[model samples]
Target: MRRSFRVLLCLAATAVGLTTLSAPANAAAHNYVALGDSYSSGVGTGGTYSGGGCKRSTNAYPQLWANTHAPASFNFAACSGATTTDVLNSQLGSLTARTTLVTISIGGNDAGFVDVITTCTLGSDSTCVNRVEQGKTFARNTLPARLDNVYSAIRQRSPSARVVVLGYPRFYKVPGSCNVGLSDTKRSAINSGADVLAQVTAQRAAAAGFTFVDIRGAWTGHEICSGDWWLNSLTWPVEESYHPNKNGQARGYLPALNAVTG
Candidate 1:
């Protein structure tokens, strides 16, 4: 009877070891799909995958996360210039029942972000302020409903996946003393617009039962003109302006997403 008991104990210990060994394989098998706009696509991070028109960079947060985690499948479907409607039409196909993780940073385009920035950078201060206000109004009023639809679509497409909605960071550091061409007043206005965008995004994300990753605080002291700026200033390719640099992806956005996804 003693010998039989020892054999049984050995068998149980072996079984436990096998299970432990297999756990990593199971984790590595999860499907992760990234869906969003230019930020997620790594517009300013400066590298591109062939033939997506989305300008996806190898250093983008989603790619960075995937490289570290080694998910069984990784899909980058985020696009440059993608609005909420563009996502609904073009990006949703990437999600499926097998998807285990989804990360997105959108709604900037929907809020007329480019228009506001253009006005702020080139137009008069008063015009910049007025356009920024218009963008803010849209963010507060119309953006929520649009966000809900996209969130709902994601839920329907990937019922069991964990969805994380990442908010945009302010382009300027607070107390707005940046020398990035735009005046301090315009910088403040842009920062305020970022705040509104984050607020509305967080609300909608919660309402849809998704996690909202607020990047505002993480990006503090790392705006366009800061010594350790993670975002690009007005660059040669204009499109890269105001977008996160490679450091922002590797440091700023990557850690934020990891905290939630982990």
Candidate 2:
């Protein structure tokens, strides 16, 4: 009886040691890496980090999620004006085997979002509509393959990571009017561009086995023309125009990211 009791105690101690060893390994699996474009970088949201021209905001969704969840490690690699190629060339290095969570908002730049918005807002109505249609064409035709390459690279770099692809919110609230300078026709065109971006992004994300978070619905009543606008319109600093405001990051994006990642 005494020998049997001693053996049982030894086994229990060994089990406890094994559990202890595994705890940290499990925690380390929570390493997170954020990547993408101006939307992800929080360009128009007011704050900047490191001044490398990325304009990363403290209140961006990734940062907000990281602060709330307290992951084992967080790497913020999103940059303003980043296209699919930029992420492949510059940001993919941040991912590794241990990276378990990844979130990115991309493809807008590749679709010439900035250029489209600039042309639409400042040019003739016909010109604006034509530019927007061109953007949609790019999103449907060229953007997918570029996105596939980036997504594949990310998977290859961090095979274990759970990638979440976030899409843009529509800039204007439709069926309503505002004194924000954009004609109803121009607003419709720009919003159509946003829809195209979301659709293409969703398709690419699905193909890559990543979760695509569409912010359009969540941002429905809070678009640029709404009384409670989440997206900025033609701000003094031209760079600030068309991006999400700080409130948008906090209320709009943070909740969406949390829902998927949680």
Candidate 3:
């Protein structure tokens, strides 16, 4: 009958409308926020990111990923001197309901690992090794709890966000050439320090149901002392500077972007 035909047509129209409605939500563009330390801030990499005046650079990994992938909205709250608490308190505020991706690199400063490196360079003896080892142990024990809190705070702030915790790259190669005293053995210890810290960070992020992007292997050929190094080849106030040059950042961070966006 005509009445039956009308009801069938109405149902089909409603189904089509429902499909159309669901499509947009499913296809909704993503919002991204990046939070972390100097490496994440893109300090030496030297390009101006959005909110450039905040001191974050355009070539920073977050901006790179956003520009390469074209997210719907982007926030780069990564500051040069950020720590774990800094990320949870200051950077977490930048995240919102629309944020689909959140990335961070933290805990190196928390462990005061940089100071240990400086001290080791000042003198190479059992005393120096002991001090560095002590710092490493402390970082291994204490950093995870703080990172856990950071992840928890982030998830609470943006439940829909895919949080990615990035590990720091190995600054020195097998035999760092920064100083004459930096022997192969000493350099190994430094690499070990970075490896431990990175693994701990990744493990903590994984425990919180977030993704952890390890960039150590990705940056194998581009370490600090390597020719055309991505990281600075020497310490501050020293030779060629030890942070990532533009090439280093591109090599160091691109794999992370690929892993994350894929």
- Compare the candidates by TM-score and give the number of the best one: 1
Q: List the residue pairs that clash in candidate 1.
A: none
Backbone collision count in every prediction?
Answer: 0, 0, 8
lDDT tens readout by residue for model 1, 1-262: 9999999999999999998888743548779999999999999987555436788888889889989999999998988889999999999999999999999998999999889988998898999999999999999999999999999999999999989999999898656555667887888899999999999999999999999999988998888777699999888678888899999999999999988877
lDDT of each structure? Answer: 0.90, 0.89, 0.75
Among the numbered candidates, top lDDT falls to 1
* Greater-lDDT candidate between 1 and 3: 1
Q: List the residue pairs that clash in candidate 2.
A: none
Location of the lowest summed lDDT over 10 successive residues in candidate 3: 233-242
Candidate 3 has an lDDT of 0.75
Which rank order by lDDT, best down to worst?
1, 2, 3
Higher-ranked by TM-score: 2 or 3: 2
Question: Which of candidates 1 and 2 is the stronger one according to lDDT?
Answer: 1
lDDT of 3 by residue, 108-226 (tens): 88887667677767777565677668767977888889988888888988999888888888877776565546767667777878878887887888899988888888888777556
